[model samples]
Target: MPDRHVTRSGDDYAEAFSLLLPQGQAWPRDEGSTLMKVVRGLSQIWGVVETSASKLLEIESDPRITIDLLPDWERNWGLPDPCYKEPLTIDDRQRALVQRMTIEGAQSREFFISAAAYIGYSITITEYRPFMVGLDRCGDSRVYGDGTEPMYSDTFVVGSIPVCNPNGDPVALDELSEWPNYGLGPDTIRHYWTVHVHQARLTWFRCSGGQCGVDPHLRIGLATDLECLLRRWKPAHTEIIFDYSGLTPGDPMAGTP
Candidate 1:
């Protein structure tokens, strides 16, 4: 049978109790009667129980509500990510599991931005395209440095994709500091792009949505959690260079260690 819920007040419970008593006994109808007071007290006790039951129901299913059952929810969702640092707070864990379950996966810039937002990072995607003389302006950067050389698609050999020489004699995709439009190797410009990761901002906790003792102390949490997810979900044909040039030079990127 399904749970049939009914919210009742102390007065309602008292009336029900009064009905249970034997009709032979003369029960006082006045609110000041001793029996009435005893009944009201008992009824109010059950009111506390009712309040607890309602609260339990609210927290039972929603990941955001319950803190103790987070492990169970994460386990069921295949979370507590072994590869990355686990979230420090209850809010972090809940957000991770919730996002993981809801994200169906997509191959678009917007999808990645929203996904990164869930991880607490703001990002923008920059796709690289070689300049075409007829379409591009004079001030625009050219793939061949001066736009004199004709851009042609290089043959991609299976399992033989060229790699930058370790000794630096011949440069590869990211050997140059600013990614020189022209490189000595095959044109892999189409195979690469930049994801500008914005600087982390402070999120203050408010009483409305903030969990006491939880959100107040909660920082922006971790950036790697989202970075790893983005890297994992990116299309296989291309590579992404994370540009964390928010305020200063952020974490290590392409050419850097």
Candidate 2:
């Protein structure tokens, strides 16, 4: 187990405390408030970051993986308009990897890395909200107002599918020429709809974790832990303060620090 201690005193402390307050509201003085209890529970779990990082480090002596916190449009499937066709499918191995990493205890470094890769891919796919339009074409039919008008379309909408390679160079989509034939006219149109539907499915899997019964918070927490580990593994010059020196208890709306 790594250092299960969270350094309190600055922004880290303030931010954690802030989580207890409602948006635009100040932290309540009463310690018995429900929000305070929730905050306390979260604070206790701050050790989770250390525990997770330790597990990851154990699996890989030099555990360092690059994650695009701010992926570009091309990397994220060109959201709002993808160029590929076909739904992205997570292989059985990858699904299992996510499950293992999301478990309540320490997990393999491979599992953590795979889960991060999948999450990175999923995040990119989810950015393109139009994927659902493509899925609607292949699945059931639907109607809007009065349930009379059919929303089905002959052409399939297309989007990007993220492919996580063994080398860690995950791509949103493969070569456009490699897409499967959907028996639809014009390769371009088919590609368009496939990308759209694929993104929608990927989004769902990312959010639901593919029925692995893993809590969303766990995944998010693990990711955060991994990021911290990576940063420490490879020293950087970034300056991040954990200080909360002048913060006072008052309504945030009133501009109280």
Candidate 3:
């Protein structure tokens, strides 16, 4: 077994005190004597220093073994976790600290999956590649016309335009009260991936780790932490779609690489 603390010991304090005494005038080294009282009083200061040093070692050992320094560590790590912000329990704070201890900035699939895990979500990633070979970087936007909409046919609704903001009333021959000024190239489907979340992050009461009224286990809500984290860290060129169907991938050919 290991010592739980470091103690300043082995007669050093007492011996030094005796050394300063007049030569051959017997120093009262026994308990409860005046010189003994002085030695013990001096040892108290050393004791406090030793105890604090030991606690510092324990705190530096791991985030979970923290003492009064937990809040300080969180501040240094820039936590209160910008992604999730509901829980304020000891367990939740400790878990957040552990997650942040090893976090490295990344954009890999595995990195995002682990990031979601930190916020108690189960998610899967799906990658996409455009099947259109001649598509340039400035690809066309997809307008799903079934060859039946007014824009795809000669059928006309008066003052109707193919521009966005279809519901707005027409301002002029071809203008609308709110017409979109620009278009997006490479429709989202071609430049995006989807995150299929399998279940809600539901927390029930726990017996092993529950506190009387503080352990933050009654959670039941659709939290946006995972979505926020993923969106913030995803590749700049890629977009993200979230599926809350709680079912397998509905895409016919979707497969993990």
lDDT of each: 0.58, 0.32, 0.58
Candidate 1, poorest ten consecutive residues by summed lDDT: 144-153
lDDT of 2 by residue, 1-257 (tens): 34334334333553567655576445564567666666666665555565555544443232122122112322333221121122222222233233334445322223434433443321111111232434435533322222222222224332333322222233223212122223434333322211011111122333312335532221211123224432342214332222123323323232100
- Candidate 3 per-residue lDDT, tens place, 130-233, comes to 34433322433323343323342112234543422222212233332231222344545556767878756655555533466675546653647778777888
Candidate 3, residue 32: the lDDT equals 71
Ranking by TM-score: 1, 3, 2
Candidate 2 vs candidate 3, TM-score winner:
3
Off by over 4 Å in 2: 1-15, 19-26, 43-46, 58-257
| Number of backbone clashes in candidate 2 | 19
Model 1, 73-142: lDDT tens digits are: 8889898876456324555566667776788999767678777666556576666555444433444232
TM-score of each: 0.59, 0.16, 0.58
* Residue ranges of candidate 1 with Cα displaced over 4 Å: 1-6, 26-34, 56-60, 63-72, 81-94, 129-184, 187-189, 208-222, 248-257
Best by TM-score: 1
Greater-TM-score candidate between 1 and 3: 1
**Model 3 regions lying over 4 Å from their true place:** 1-5, 9-26, 98-101, 129-187, 200-213, 217-221, 247-257
